[model samples]
Target: MIFFIYQIVTKPLTSKLIRNEACPVCNTQDSLELTLYMRYIAMLIPLFGMGRRTSVICTNCGNVLKNPDSSIFAKKKYSNKVADAVKDIRQNHKRTLWQLVYPWSIWFILPFLILILLGISAINKKNTEEKAKEYAELIMHPQTGDIYKSTWFENGLSQGVLVKLMRINGDTLYVVKTKQKIQMSFSKDEWNKLSADPAAFEAKEYKIKNFSILKETNFGDLFMYNNDENGKQYPIYLGAILNSKCEMDLGFETIERKK
Candidate 1:
């Protein structure tokens, strides 16, 4: 019984296996020894799965086995998945020619748009300045009063002189000295030129007087002509109008004095 048990223990397990050994279960010499490599391959089948290439099976007993060749398995699976993905991508791919062109087109177009906007703004600013200057020039000229409706002048020289003159009455003109420090000044002749023809004055040469502050309520006109004061009765053009101010000079010279 011990010898029988030893025979059974020493026997091979499968018939289709490569080695000629007796069967362990029945003690029959018809059994064959299973190859270690084949056993190893069989063990790896479930682990590797059906996706693998090198498969195995016992020819006589028909036992399913695994043969995991990592290189072949990986290559076949990777190739199949990659091929399927490539086919799907090809089917779904849309040709967007506009997408490639838009960014570069915007790079050129944006600058042109900016330049056009800047040009329009500059034109608007120029027109505003010209209108202001024209109004200022018109207000400066004593004769232009009939041409424009709302226009007035205040002191001797609005731009040139620091000392602002105010008309007290027909006989006297009051002088208001400015406390705020200013740099520019005008000569008597320069003041005369400005008073005579304000259009002739250059904007770059002189700054506009502070017209907002010097109104009729704060500082009256320096030279107001009554019926008897001047030979011809005309209102003084000494205050600030729309754009330009009265020609300011060093001396508080009235319109009568200027004449």
Candidate 2:
């Protein structure tokens, strides 16, 4: 008669019994040690029993085995679930990191660059308006204060002559006719205390009365205009105009003389 003797070892199993054993499901040889203490801890839990105690696990197939209870294969099931959850979390984390880094590294800089570009565009438009105003002032006759026009006459009959007028203030310019008015009225204190405040004062209008083109024998033809009937077309020098109440003043400086 033969008798089978079974003994429990106190020392934890260190040497692997099935070293490099390939899992039948996934054919992986990787395995980890599961000590008896860890097995006891797992077994004490209500969710784990002796049959579901810790043991070596196949890294690939996730299979588990026990010396006593292979039927209690709870560890393999739990491990597989945990592994799947971990894999999903890792994948999602990787995707999230990539998404955040990609935009911040490349696309995020666009807003600042776009703002700079918009600023440059606005500055360019302002500069262009200023230059256009300066050119218009250059083309206008300073004496007559009229825009110049070139025309051709047929049989001493000149028709369809183009007329233009331009005016400049600061960096801005306007076109006006001899019959129209551009009044500039202000108090003396206001004129003396000229400031950059845009709302400080209001502008008035003045009309152009007389305008004519004259021919000089020695010099070229001249263009002249007057704000009053008796006002002669003299070379306009710098001067200041005072209001009747002495509360307002206006200053003028000739930039050019028409010929």
Say which candidate scores most in TM-score: 1
TM-score of 1: 0.22
Per-residue CA lDDT of candidate 1, range 26-139, in tens? 444433222211111123221111221222234445443323333443433212433343344334444244322432466777999999999998876776666545444433
Q: In model 1, which runs have C-alpha deviations exceeding 4 angstroms?
A: 1-106, 147-259
Model 1: per-residue Cα lDDT at residue 11: 15
For each candidate, what TM-score against the reference?
Answer: 0.22, 0.21
lDDT of 2: 0.33
lDDT (Cα, tens digit) per residue for candidate 2, span 1-259: 9864433323232323244444555665545323231122122222211211224555555555433234443445334543443334334432223223421354676888999999998876676565444433443323334332212132544221112334444322233322221223333343223332323222422232222122122111122333356765443211111211112112321122245
- Summing lDDT over every window of 10 consecutive residues in candidate 2, give the lowest-scoring window: 237-246
- CA shift of 119, model 2, Å: 0.8
Listed per model in order, the count of residue pairs whose N, CA or C atoms clash below 3 Å is: 15, 9
